[model samples]
Target: MAISSLQEHPGSEVTVWMADGIYPISEPLVFGPRELGEEGTLVFKAQQDAQPVISGGVEISGWIKNSEGLWEAALPKELDETSGFRELFISGKRAARARFPNEGYLRVKQAGVDRRTNFYFQKGDFPIPVNLEGVELVFLHDWSISRIGIQEIDTAADQLIAVDSIGARIPAFFTIDNWEPHPRYFLENAPEFLDADYEWIFLKSQNKVLLKLPQNVNPTNSKVSIPFSQGLIVVEGEENYPVKNIHFEGITFQYSKWEIPEKGYSGIQACHFDPRPSNEGWAVVPAAIISIWSENITFTDCNFRNLGGSGIWFGPGSKNCKIIDSSLKDIAGNGIMIGEGQDRIVNGQPWWKSAPEQVASGNVVENSTISQVGSQFYGAVGIWCGLTAQTAIKNNVLFDLPYTGISVGWMWSPEATPARENIISGNHIHEIMNILSDGGGIYLLGLQPESKVLDNRIHGVKVNAGRAESNGMFLDEGITGVLVEGNLVYDIAKSPLRFHRATTNLVRGNFFFSDDSNPPIRYNTTDEEAIEKVDNLFFSEGEPSYQKELSHAISRWEKKQRKKRKR
Candidate 1:
């Protein structure tokens, strides 16, 4: 094998030339230390003037009309139902699964948990059929959403019993009107609910699919596909013999799935699927390109879209890697992640352990665009770093995400040993936190001394459902000795900048614009001496270049406050 050959000659060079077509991968492509080819020269690239795509999808055809004028097709026998694929694509566009009450969400009147993992709803609230078993119950909380499976529907007693997840647990206060049942939720994957155009449903047990195609779209003429692979690529190396010199260029990766956790999903802040809790409320999130304990690996001018998890993760011990000039869009989780969550914390202290090479250092993700992430995870960011040190994320455009745009540091404490000297600059992050609240476009946590956020532009934050706040740059608890400068921020539901227990940071030369009634800065319990320098405290003040619209909004708010006082 080429891999064995490469391992035989540790520092040799090899190239994989890919043709210009989609390669549907049913299994993951793993590159371990055995695949490394010395120094940093092993390359995986598309052929000259060719565009190659590595896909996790398999196309379906051979459609015929059913008696009811709907289209039907039999799935390949080799494809099993236990794969847990919930995503389907048609003609390269995502298709909606058959869902009940398509236009509006049904109100959940009253719900209570019971034995066998059952959820009892108020009688007469549910109108779906009793045979609608195996459907997904999509539940939404403050910033968390989960899709649970249905085992039985009791129409007469107004109760739906969920599939038993043995050790699943929920927060005691996460009950109806406490965690608070969202007023809107709908069920999915019932063929009887396939009433709308472009909707689809899979007969899992029968290995068949039913579809309602749009006008002028024939099933054979269009492409219908399902994502079967949960992970498409994995690069693993060891502490002493880390994989080196691996590169991927001009390739497109598409359509991977995230498995529904067997232990049942729990609510993590930011809608991340931390299925089970470890100590300190931490959970694990996975990505498609998961590289562990590797070095000098790179991906350039690539595309990652329609994926089910994070795009690429250079995990603990990965060093000097690069992801540049790429696009990661329409993904369900974070775009790119550096380091691991467990490495970010240990017993409430900064974790600086190095046994398995548990530190991501000197990685670079630059000049790329990532958007529409957290489509399913709801709490994922475009770029995330956890306990990573000396990393650089620059010149990236992050937009249309459900939560934070760029997030660094995960320790949630001021212990500065875990992460340090990171650079986050020259990124355009906007139109984020579109769903979850209590987040910022550029959010920082823990104590990453000398880490900097510079020259970034952020805006377009809105509150949804919960009372949690959303901002442009949120420096959360345990932050210290970082630089925040030259960022243009505005249009936030909360203050443009908020610091909670952050200290010894430099906040200078940054512009802040907001329609919020609160001050430009929300400093809660943070020492007044925390910010070493507050020069240009606010943007363009008292100069001819002062923003007229901002001054006018402030004057209007002042007048309204005065009127309220007089009344």
Candidate 2:
């Protein structure tokens, strides 16, 4: 019979026969790539009763071939258990060798199994060469099948397989090679491959990234040199790269402590360079341990602890900044300092032979806790705002501070060209002890125009006799348009509130109480009569002498008001 083109229907087997005993089984045979596709079985069967002596009980087994011309034998009913296994075989000329490529491995339960079988053909060893580039090989055993190996042929093909296996886009930059161990090990050990020249290099480890400084590359212009403009550039575990206009959330900076000149070495020093006053050059003198000099920046929900100097410091040029919902503790200097720049003038002569530059402006620090700062000999304020305009310190809770809770001062430039508009409000300050320092809950000094100190609660402020001048709130010298109102001051050692050389200030609606050995409030060289003492609840109700003095002051105020009406 002559062979013709045949087509098979669904669920039915088709057979084809050629003349001269050369038979081709077209049914149950799929010719194409061997991939996971539609679920159907391909079975090939030899024609029964074709010859006189039928090979009965001696069945001839066959296998399937893939696009790479590799033959994989089909498993019997008991051996075909897993759905992932596929088989292929190859045919070569002269010497037929069925070679399993690297991609052909099956994981099986019973370890030792014969993978090669010897079959004698009439044509004296017909050679079959197996091509394995894109072939799938499967092995089957009784009731169990295993995948022993998987061959990744090419890089692009392997990447495609990986993406398809994971059902997602493979991360472009990741430690895929080190999938067994931690990924950081690969990132840290391997050098980054970049096309362009980058000065800074960061090696990320498990906990931190170590930034290697270029060898012997001293920056002539600045002390601390940051080579990168953006992203994380880890510098000795301190990431100090300049990130422009990007919000970096939930990053912790661990700085090594350096000792002060007086103290022994081994603490983190707060060293940041300030470009202002131009002539001061780089203020390499350590200011705060972790000084942030970025403009329009905010640090929220952060922790800055165990530092040698201030916890966080902001330079003068830093504006519209916020440090909120953070805790700063156990520092040698102030906890959080805003605008504490160096004095432009060194001595009688300006450092640049002129007045110091104008200070920074518009800093806000709110909803923070500062505690356990400054050792016995040294003193530190909780929140210190210096030489900055429109700076606000509000809703903070400060305790165990050696000097003051909140201090606003013009200590750097006495000229006050920049007009510090400081506001300290709604803060709970207590337990500040300092000797030979103006210890207070809130201290304002030297020409803060338009400053408001309101709604603060202060208690347990102690000043040792002949040690320091203590007050709940102290305003000193050349402060104008100041309002100290609605504060509860109690248990103060010296005075609840004191003013020295302060002018045009409104002191009203404050509750001042001092129990034994401390004055309720005092004023020195200030226009005490002009201070509005309205609605001030003083705790002198039981003491008749104190009450008489309070009455006399009220009468004196009334008499002065009548005289003003007459005038």
Candidate 3:
């Protein structure tokens, strides 16, 4: 009623103050152009010295100890099959889903007769669970992960069949020894797999949750929460009429959920999935807070945590927006995503036909912290930007992720798009690419002209068990006209800088230190003359041997690429 009245009356500026309390919403609060009026500015902020919470979770009570000694709780009758959630929180901490083996993963012994959707497990990997309902098999491929329901367990053949095709459209990403030497997998959301503490499983048929808490921790004394809503807030506008000058401050958004699609999740990189058997379209995991066709929107001093998917997204037709002094952590997918894919081009067309107003540009994210993302999706990144221009990301700390920390650009061809002149500077990225390979602290791709990556401190990139190597910076296919300067990258298992099919990039004034046996730079099937290296200081074991090692590395990489192409 208050908002509708405000839309009717013409006001230059409006402010809504939120008190210190938990505000739970069943659906996303949507704000459109009508809410902003012409030349109007709307602000939603917390009261001074107060903290306001917007939550999408429902509190779960009425716990009872089953005869098996596990605590069970009946979910609300309002929640049905569509309300199935992937995460649970107990007293402000995330609880793990019931997974087999307790630690590490089980390797695929062989590719099944039809390798796309089934794989043979090694002997004694797992026993058939008492119930197969709601059971999912999580497959860890080279650069992506796939989750699918099990169709059958052929114990006699030692094979497992998935309900759908696993991983991306490529066959090498699913079968073992094709792209990756050994594909690892695990079983999830089965009662027989719940062996450790802080584990939970949801039975959809019974509409209940079974939890195994830590020793001597009673469920009656703990507060349990299940995320029920998919999106918390959505700001939308049309092409000509946009939502303008809306600001949010000092608020916390939490506990939004994400559900797997009916066909299953066939992940590509950066939380994007191929959602069809025919590989028709590419889709991304949804964000809890989304702003599209909007301008001059700002989120300052806010918090986003315990989210089942990405935290915030500024999609197509967003411009001059800012996210400053915020914190995003414990998210199941990417912390933030800016812009949309070329396949799903919105509010704009190809560069030759795109209008300046239709492009998402001039966005900024500064002075913030992002950590502990990709909790469930291993292929997710900390921050992902696609087909956007002049996006500035500065002075942020990103760490503790499963894959890349920051990913910019999406197209893999040199054909022109809307991406250009973006800047990533002074960010501290570390401890990323922890579980996945073929990525880095900063991964850049495609034809983003004159983009700059400057003065970033990146370290602690470790080796992984996947096919490709992990690096401090990975410049992948069709990268053109990018400048990498004054960055400090060290302690990487692979080369500090790896270029694959990249062209016309400049690396200068950067300090690269390494303790690994690999060279400081790697050229994988890329022309050496394409990237100009000027005045870069390279140190290995306290000596400068980049010139000698780079020559050897190029030869080895070329030979390896030859063999891979033949395969």
- Predicted structure with the largest TM-score when compared to the true one: 3
**lDDT comparing candidate 1 with the true structure:** 0.74
Q: Model 3, poorest ten-residue lDDT window? A: 344-353
**TM-score of candidate 2 versus the correct structure, residues matched by position:** 0.47
Tens-digit lDDT track of model 3 for 1-567: 546556776665678899999999878889988666756778889999999999999888899888888999888765765648889998868999999978888888887766787888776888688778889998887778888889988888888888877777753445544565457888999988988889999998888899997769997897799888888999999878888888999999988989888667878888988767556557899999999989999999999999988889999899999999999999988899998887653355453245644668999998889999988898999889988899999888899989998999988878777789999987889998888899999998888899999878788888566879899999998888899997878778788899999888899988787764878889997998988999997878455675465455445434644563476
Better of 1 and 3 by lDDT: 3
Instruction: Give the alpha carbon lDDT tens digit for every residue of 1-567 in model 1.
Output: 656657676667778888899888887898877545445356779999898989987877789988887898887655654554667788777788888778656656656454325556666554575464457776655555556777778777777666643112444444434444433456888876889888888876767788998767798887888777778889888777788878999999998877666545554654344455343444555788889878888999999988877788998789999999999988877889888665355456544753323578999998899988876677678888887889999878898888889888877677645588999887878888876666788889898888999877777886645555688988988888888987777677778888888877888977787553657788877986767656644543444544775555445544644563476
Clashes of each: 3, 29, 0
Q: By lDDT, who's the top model here?
A: 3
TM-score of each: 0.86, 0.47, 0.93
Q: Rate the local accuracy (lDDT) of all candidates.
A: 0.74, 0.45, 0.84
Question: Which pairs clash in the backbone of model 1?
Answer: 40-245, 270-379, 438-469
- Candidate 2 lDDT over 1-567, as tens digits, reads 101111222223233321223222211111211121112222222234332110001111343333433222333343233221111111100111122221222121111112111101222111121222222122221111111122332332211111111100112211122121111000001122111111111221221112222334222222221111111111011112321121212333222132322111111112222222232433332333223333445656555544444566665455666777777765545677777544555456533224333355677888788886653113456776766788888878898875677877754223455655688887878887543245588878777677799888787776542323678888877766788887877668878888787767788887777656656777778787766667787875356575555555445444644563476
Error of 3 at 560 (Å): 40
Residue pairs in steric clash, candidate 3?
none
